[model samples]
Every structure is written in structure tokens, then in C-alpha cells.
Target: MPDQSPSSRRFRADSCFVTGGALLALLVVGGLFWAKYNMSTVKEWRGGNAWNLTYEAAAVSGDPRAAAVRYRHNPDSFRKDFRDERLGAIRLPWHTEANVNTGAVARMEVAPAGEGQVSCRILLDGVRVVAEGRSPAPGEPAVCEVTTSSTPEKWPTKPS
Candidate 1:
């Protein structure tokens, strides 16, 4: 058997080092990508859950107008009253129209074209009517606009 050369051993050690470094880098990159993907997915799920909570609250109350009123008056209070813990962090400007004829403080209109129908117009920032839904029958789903801005991202994570 021939004598093993020191230079050859050194060369093999260097190769091993380079290969190990490359694998570590690849693992770090893959971990970063996975973290980013998980964060985005969590954000999306929270957004959908927030909207669903709002709709569920309205449906349970059987009065979208009242729900809008509560939200418009005080978002924090509304969240507490409705037990919406997940969406309590979100904040948004809301406008509810008070009925003059019926002396009711609500944004929803019943019988806009006669009885047996209810319509609601929910505005954002007092300028844009973000949601408009009409129900011809009682206990029907109130269709409201779903926008990205309506999510928790609207509020800053930290207090300003």
C-alpha cells in the first residue's frame, strides 16, 4: 500500500468543509422561506376570521343596523360587547345612518321599497360605502363588502 499523503488528506478535509457549509446555507434559506409562508398564511386566516366574527355578531343580534351602530360608536366597546376577542385588535372608521322617520339609531333601512325587505349601507370613513346588502326575507344572510383594508392590518401593532 502506498503511503497516504498529508496534502491529499488536507484536500479531502477542505472539500468536506465546503460541502457542509453549502448544506447549512441551503437549510437556512429553506427555513426562512417556510417562516415567511407561515406568516402570510396566518395573516390571511386572521383576516377571514375577523370578517366572519363581525358577520356572526350581526346575524346573532338579528340587527345589522344596531351592530353597525355599536361598532361606529366605539369599536373597542363593540368588540367587548360581542365577545369578539380575535378582532378586537382591528380598528376602522364606520358610519351608521340614523333613521329620522322611525326614531331609530341604525344604519339599516327596512322597507326601502315596502315591507318584507331590509337593506343596509355601511360606510367607511364617512365617505365610502363599503358594504351594501339587502335581504328580502327575515333571517337571511346580510351581504357585506369584504376588503383587505377591513382586516387587522389597518391598526398598528404597537401603540403610536
Candidate 2:
């Protein structure tokens, strides 16, 4: 075998350095992707586990008998529209809206099950009904039983 010169050895060393650098970059990028996914796991779980509904505002028509409920997802733009430090402004995954008539009893029932479950219920009479839906697992939409007999004359058309 012939003796190798110094230049040949230097060339081999440079090739190893470049290859190592490329491998290091790949590892860093992969790690970042993994971390990002882990951090967003909560969001993904909530997205699939909350109840959502859209109903007419009771104040609009002042008719308690005219109410509807269903499952729906929270609006993506709601957080930006309102700011409340107490709620952590996290913009929950589900919510409800309804129109209530005068002299009506609006009641909400919520039972949540799972890790880190979030439960919320709200009632509004003769005006508006808004509620939050959050839980640890996917389930049925929270129920709000409204009770009112015969419409009242000159119903107050304001929600406070």
C-alpha cells in the first residue's frame, strides 16, 4: 500500500465535519416538532370533548317558548372580542346561546367527567342565555330546562 499525503487526510476530515453538522440540524428540527405537538395536546383534546350550541337570543323576540338547543363549537374569534383575566381568556371549546321570554325560569345542568374537566352552566331570563361547555371527554350537550307558562304582557325587552 502507498503512503497517503496530509492533503488526503484533511479532505476526509472535512467530509466528516459536514456530515455531522447536517445530522445535528435534523435532530434539532425533529425535537422541535415533537415538543410543539406535546404542548398542543390539551387543545386537541378539548376540541373533541366540548359541547357547542347556537340559538336565537331570547331578547330579540321576547318569547320564552321559542328556544332551541344543539351542539356547537366555540367561535374562534370570541377571545379576541372580549377580554376577561379571570377566565384565563383561554376561549373554552364550547358555548350556548338562547332567546328567553319574560317570567321564565332558565336552568342549566352540567356534569363533567375526566382529567382536567371544565364544567360551566348559565341561565338568563327574558333576555339572553349564554353558557360555556367544557369537559375532559366528549359527551352530550349540557341541558338547560326553561319553564314559563303563557307569555307575559308588555314583557321587558332588555337583558341585564
Candidate 3:
């Protein structure tokens, strides 16, 4: 080319550096936004996985009431109690958060169903019927396995 001054060459190099830097920064910012937008989808996936694992464990254990209690205390405990290595790999940020509580128990009524059994009706969270079974009259107790249809939508959006 014609005579190009040293200052002009340096300016060109600087402009190239600045443009590359801006592009890189823009990509990083875009990635962060993408991750934020998909966070709910990720949580939804995790919740579904957890619920399925819990349901399997409860079904096998044949104790819905105990399962419900355990879920209340620690939702992630099922993965551990059942030795689910797959689920253990995915850690949830809100593992200790309670999804259901005593206040969620809308109603619980027990009455005699027969000589040795009592009818039980337990409602939870004004929506789910946690338990309904004919339990033993006194000594022996019936098992009521309660599960939630709760998805990530039910989970707290903000950190607790």
C-alpha cells in the first residue's frame, strides 16, 4: 500500500482489539441471559425427576403416609434413602425447603368404618387429598401415601 504512518497502524490494531473484545463481552452477556431464561425449565426437569423417584420409592415401600412425611421433611432424602445414584448427581438448590406443611393439611377426619378399621380422610394444601384409607381401629395403623402434583411452578421463585 501507500505510505502508512506508524500511528495509523497502531490505531487500526487498537480498533480491531476493541471490536473483538466487545464481541466477546456480548457473547458472554448473551450466554448469561440464556441461562437465566432456561433456569425454570431446568428446575422443572429436576422436580419431575425427583417426584418420579419419590413415587417409585413410595410405591415400593407401600407407605404413602411415611413417604409424604419424609418428603415434607426433606424432599431430596428419597434419592438418598433409595440409593438412587442417578438423582444424587443432580443437586437441587432448595433441597431442604418444605413443599408441604401441617398448615397445608386442610382436613383430617377419622371415624369407624368397621369393627377393626377406621375411615380416614386427610386433605392437604387445600388441594391434594393426602390420605384416604381404612386404618386399623387401634393398634395397627393404615398407610396413606400422599404425593403432590407440584412442579417447579410450586417452588419458591426467590431464595428462602
Candidate 4:
């Protein structure tokens, strides 16, 4: 039993149109994000044609406090090899081995809990160097990573 004039109708339409436009925009963005996630995160999940991989890392320039060595070779989960929540931080010179496969990504990261220089190495077939990373600064990470599908044997860059 209120006003149903042209101006009131127009205001209601404008409000609904703004709300609908926002919803549509959110839907489009979410769809694009889901597509990209499926493309990278799920594409190499199977990790076909297995191979042995080794990840090694060393951190120098240590403080009295400790640091963390983190790594991942397959798509499943990353590992922080030497971390104890109850205790203080741990020093580094960490290594691990993984059975990876084609189309898999191998990565190593050094997260310094304190002041330090960090570096990492990835080896394929137990002898050949595949990838390496070094910490950029005292606070930044030194990350070394590589995709296994890119002819690991043909790669000639060795760690020093």
C-alpha cells in the first residue's frame, strides 16, 4: 500500500541489477580460479613412470637460533624434515630421497627460522644433478625446484 511510482521502480531495479552483476562477476572469477587449480594442481597427480630422486640442502651463516629445511618431490605433500614444535629451531644440512615419476615436480626450500644463508640441491638417478636453489637473502627462501618431465638426464647443471 505504498508508492509504486516510476522513480521507486527505477531505484529497485538499479539495486537488483547491481547485486546481480556482483554475483555474476563472482561466479566468473570462481570458475576461472577452479579451472586453473585443476590444470596445475591436479594435472600431474598420478606421477607416471617412476624414478628415484634425492633432495639435499645445506645452510650456513647460522645464528644461535635454528632454521628449517623443507622439501617436496611429488604432488602429495611437502615435508619439513627437521621440525619439533615443542623445542627450539633445528640446524640444517638435511637430505631425503623420493620415488618420483614423469610429469612430477621436485622442489626443495630452506626456511630460516633465524639469520642464515641457505642452499638446496636435487639429484636424479642418485648421481646426476637435476636442480638447485640458494637463498636470496637472510630472510628470503632459497628454493631449488624442477619438473621431472623436462629430460632430467639431458640437464647438465651440477651443484657446487
RMSD of each: 13.7, 19.0, 12.7, 17.5
Question: What's model 2's lDDT at 98?
Answer: 37
What lDDT tens digits, residue by residue, belong to model 3 across residues 55-117?
111111222222121223223422422221112211111122233321121122222212233
Shift of residue 138 alpha carbon in model 2, Å: 36
Give the poorly placed runs of model 4, Cα more than 4 Å off.
1-48, 64-66, 75-89, 150-160
* TM-score, per-candidate, Cα-based: 0.33, 0.28, 0.36, 0.51
Candidate 4 per-residue lDDT over residues 1-160, each given as its tens digit: 9899999999999999999999999999999999766754453453244457787767656652336666654433232232211223555666678755555566666676666777778888768877887778886667887776533224336456
Model 2 Cα lDDT, one tens digit per residue, 1-160: 7558898888888999999999999999998998766644544344322222232212111122212233222234222121111111122333445333323333443332222233444533423434433333533223444342223323234365
What lDDT score belongs to each candidate, Candidate 1 first? 0.38, 0.38, 0.37, 0.64
Q: For residue 34, what is the lDDT in candidate 1? A: 92
lDDT at position 40, candidate 1: 47
Which scores higher on lDDT, 2 or 3?
2
Model 1, span 53-151: residue lDDT tens = 122122223332322222222233223222211222111222333211111122232222212234445543344444567654664433443332333
Position 66, candidate 2: lDDT? 16
Candidate 1 vs candidate 2: the TM-score winner is 1
Lowest lDDT 10-residue stretch of candidate 2: 80-89
What are the clashing pairs of model 3?
Answer: 64-144, 64-145, 65-144, 104-125
Task: Determine the C-alpha RMSD for candidate 1 after optimal superposition of all C-alphas.
Answer: 13.7
Q: Per-residue error at 20 for model 4, in Å? A: 81
